[model samples]
Target: MPSGPEVLQAIDWRQPWLAGWREWGEPVAQAVADGLPLHEALNHRSAAPVRFVPQAALPPGEAYERYIFNSGLCPTREGLHDFFNGLCWMRFPRIKTRLNQLQAAEIAAAGVAPLRGPVRDALTVFDENAAFLLAPPPLWEALMGKDWQALFVALRPLWPQARLVLFGHALLEKLVYPRKPITAHVYLAPPAIDTIANLDAWLAADLGADKLAGKPFVPLPVLGVPGWWPENENFSFYDDSLVFRPRR
Candidate 1:
């Protein structure tokens, strides 16, 4: 019998994207290890915004998209993917809803492009590894330049405003093995400090899609955060002159 953190501790925090969910995965991991189904557990949560449907009884294939779109019921299949997805939904309902709307529209429009259009690409990235980043212009510039030190160290005090949310199930699935380029989309917004208590709710703020209009999601190397990844702690990883060297 393993504790929640113990089960989640097995996940590699060295992976930056996963570093975000290390806190939220506890309950889910405990549930999983206990052989408890999340679908039933979801119902009991009075705070849960949407209902969970394990294997969502749909007509199979694309038809299900329309149902989810119309019903607002999040599809919770099996495996770690759906489990993590459920947690993400609980954490980031607004962003997740907006993304679902975008994806469903794309599916309806082009019928799922092989390469995916811009909207779909954006949606996919956010769905898997989006981070809620709030930073001053300098820190933002440092991030854009891939200068980890300036972004995480020199700008440490401003960190309270700077939050990151990992709201993607695919991110967790990938972290099961772990790898580099821990990708995340930096959604530039200041979260409600007191209202949203946890990373899950902070990521799922009650914001609308229009808020993100014209604000292009800046791609980020999530591992660059100071203490987010273990390797990033001693500044060893930032020594990569090829990628993180400050621009002259």
Candidate 2:
């Protein structure tokens, strides 16, 4: 797997708006243009203070929009660069529901038992700003299949400036070989495996604030088996290698 600094250095490193989508399909590209504005796309830092409506005010399908909009304003066009086709529930309902349940269960199981320091560090980054982004698992898996050229074509337009995180058993299978023999049976639905949180209680143990926010702390994929266990003998991140760097 790529080291944290190695990953960070690879990104184009621009504010959100200045990013480009090198290969979006016409319809998806048009949808983005129609839904957001240029200012909203870049320069709008989500951590800045913003008000939000209670869940009661949103229509059933739109509850997730709270994460995308800032104080009820649609994200700027540049900000939309952070949006992924998989993040929207209207586009992937089944996966969304499964992901929520899996996450809730993990937190419940880990309740207050001090998480190992590294995992805590990961969680702190996730919770501090409630940052959100999405990925396409199938596309990611395909890339691991040694189709880097095609994956680059598809993701360039969407993540023009940054190195996208790739985690999950398939990702690992494609990118990093395991230490021992493992089964091909491990896998999770895309939604359940796509998130990275720097702020979950246990995942935030010892990291300083500077390391938990912004550039250095890019998303890291955490692989889980389809039903929520490790597909192989190694299930804990503590047992896996970890790399962290100061946020830029």
Candidate 3:
């Protein structure tokens, strides 16, 4: 693995939001720099360097209060369990263009064969988190409208050990129904982050290898055409950021 500085440099870290994250994320970086194991820092979010603290490390009586989950208009509205599998359609044009930009020598240097159009398109939206926002209002009414508080109350018993942290633009749904009950268990963060540049880092920081190993970061089409509203796989919330992994 590359040193922290080298890893940071390999990617363009010029975004201003990342700067804000510095204060919050330092502890995380420090932990990685210190050679902490992956499982220890799996789901913790810190914007700076720090040591890892496993969930098991916490006092048995004291439950973990923080959980981060990104909620969205998944392909399957009700359970939406298989949503992750349908996300690849979002990576289109961009990945194709990126691949096309490579010179034959560059392709050889990269040690990967050029992809066929259909295959590229298939993989593009494969692991997408894009369609979440496109979910019909009826779906939002069913989920968020029921009130996050009620949902949490009912859902908590199923997973007693975990606290729920929702990661998505679903907070926007609150505006339509401000009276909706909010829950202590439900937390939200701005879903907009430039994913093109940060997908790798986001996975590195959020999911870690334990969760993301062998996974591919497929993009989603937030916007598409008629048959595929907000047409075009390239235009998506993913233009800013995305979550590419098994839906779980």
Candidate 4:
């Protein structure tokens, strides 16, 4: 595995999937390049509500979310996973805080168990693998229905009007080594949210325990998003049934 600095150096901040993160990521990357630790680099660049601390800051046996909730510190480790996680906190602080709040609440109510119960499970899933998509109803209908051909091919022109922003840090981390099978748990954003800031605020306000527990997300193959991967431009790309499964 590459060191954190190496991972930082390898990222192409200009990638469409990384939009809205360059402003924060570039400076943090430079700080790491200058020999700062990943957590310290994140601290140096962050104005978010939570402080970035070394992973050791998390006491052994304490729940991660519980610690963050109690201390307002995010324990971060070196690597693409935590690197993207820090970026998510920087870019979508409100949403991250809200998720942390919910997770901490669940931990408090039920204690950390082998099975996190439904609400905590959903929160973890969202934090690790969610994406926000703003598109026309037709695009959404096709996507939610798992009609990949119609979504990616028939409505291909409509992609110009759509915006898909990756929210899950794990999803972003996996894309560093792009694979056809990498997918996102997509949440639809209100069409009015035209900017990242607006989306952050809206999503933070929109998330609730009941809503999250329902797991209202549609699966989207990240590479299939128009313009995200060049190979996807070919109609044959969607024919990979393993990646683009039909609705049951």
lDDT winner: 4
Cα TM-score of candidate 4: 0.97
Candidate 1 structure quality by residue, lDDT tens digits, 133-179: 66666777777776677776778677666656555677656556554
Q: TM-score per candidate, in order?
A: 0.72, 0.23, 0.20, 0.97
What count of clashes does model 1 give?
A: 2
Clashing pairs in 4: none
Give the per-residue lDDT digits (tens) of candidate 3, residues 71-103.
Answer: 111111211121111111121223222322222
RMSD of each: 5.1, 16.8, 20.4, 1.1
Evaluated against the true structure, the overall lDDT of model 1 is 0.61
Each model's lDDT comes to 0.61, 0.30, 0.26, 0.90
Q: lDDT of candidate 3 vs native?
A: 0.26
**What order do candidates take by TM-score, descending?**
4, 1, 2, 3
**Candidate ranking (lDDT, best to worst):** 4, 1, 2, 3
TM-score (C-alpha) between model 2 and the true structure: 0.23
- Please identify model 1 stretches exceeding 4 Å from their true place: 1-25, 112-115, 153-161, 172-180, 191-215, 241-248
lDDT of 4: 0.90
How high is the lDDT of residue 46 in model 2? Answer: 25
Q: 7-88 in candidate 4: lDDT tens per residue?
A: 8888887778887778888889888888999999998888889999999999999999999999999999988899989999
